[model samples]
Target: MSTPEVSGALAPGTHSTGAHSTVTAPPEASTFRRWTSRCGWALAVAVPLWLAVGRLLTDSAGSLTPVYAATLAPTLLVLSLVALAVPARRPSGYPSSRACGILLISWGCGIVLGFTLPDVGEGASSVLGSWAGPGFEGAAAALSNPLGIIMLFMAVLGCVVSVRHSAHGDGSGRPRDTEEDEAQGTGYFPVLDV
Candidate 1:
């Protein structure tokens, strides 16, 4: 008349190590996931430096020294957040999956907005005024450098790779078979014929 006291063991075919067996992702896939996340972390860290150096090298440009877009700050911050979200283990990846997705998206938004806004204003506060300004601070700013655009795109792409390799993808990372459950006496739902 009631569900038995089944401590709810792992379904089956999940590996036989102690205390962390619930994770079903294969060993190779797990290793690869960790690698991608690490790579993403590295790329995210480099974006600012790369952009700054590029700015510094550009000559014949006023506003000297080279100034980063407004979004650069936020993008750098979120890059860290996303890097941390990518976990070394499949089980750990589960909890931070959603956060990774969110931050990565924000990373894209920051790139687009940061590059666009400051240039628009040229010190002018109004939207129309900003766009109406001249020089790199104007509409042409976005197209000033192709490398910067590519780098920003890379940051977004890196975030995606980190998250995709995590638990957010399809069930291949984890699988539970009905037969396995029955054989283990767990039955997934744990029932018996009356």
Candidate 2:
């Protein structure tokens, strides 16, 4: 008798071979992602201002100005508005978990550096004071006065940017499963059906 034609599925011996196929779903952006993206954009804008106007606020050589500090919020506001205008995009092909882990590491490193770095002049004076008693306190005062503020701002901004970039999504700040592997059921490999 001829082997009953196994029609419904592939035959036991014969292989149903064809070109491999893959399915990819469009990425979806979330509100939180968008917010973070916007923050990133804002932070980008702030970088320049921090370098220019913000610098003036701390530099005694530049006529330490209260007005400069007052202008900071407005500058930040402008940056925020600019960021909001730009829509967030999903990351090209990065895994969210990996990105998050990297961000955490960067944040941790930044925290450690921020705490350990001697805050410019302050660090030097503090070192001197340890050896020569309180005479060097004035030299170290810069750390507590202006340098400390700038350092704090830098540390905070650096952490924010690191966290924002590490998180998935496009420039617009949305989480996207752009990686081929992520779309597939496998955590790190693209699913292929033959």
In order of listing, the candidates' clash counts read 1, 10
Q: Over the stretch 1-194, how does candidate 2's per-residue lDDT look in tens digits?
A: 78765455543434444543333333544544444444445454554344334323333213322333354334433434332332223242222222323333333332222222221332232333444455654654443345434434543443344344434333323443546336654454234210
Residue 123, model 2: lDDT of 26
Question: What value of lDDT does candidate 1 attain over all alpha carbons?
Answer: 0.44
Q: For model 2, state the Cα shift of residue 178 in Å.
A: 16
lDDT of each: 0.44, 0.37
TM-score of each: 0.37, 0.29
Best by TM-score: 1
Superposition TM-score, candidate 1 onto the true structure: 0.37
Q: Cα lDDT for residue 43, model 2?
A: 50
Model 1 poorest ten-residue lDDT run: 120-129
Model 1 pairs in collision? 120-130
Compute the lDDT for candidate 2: 0.37
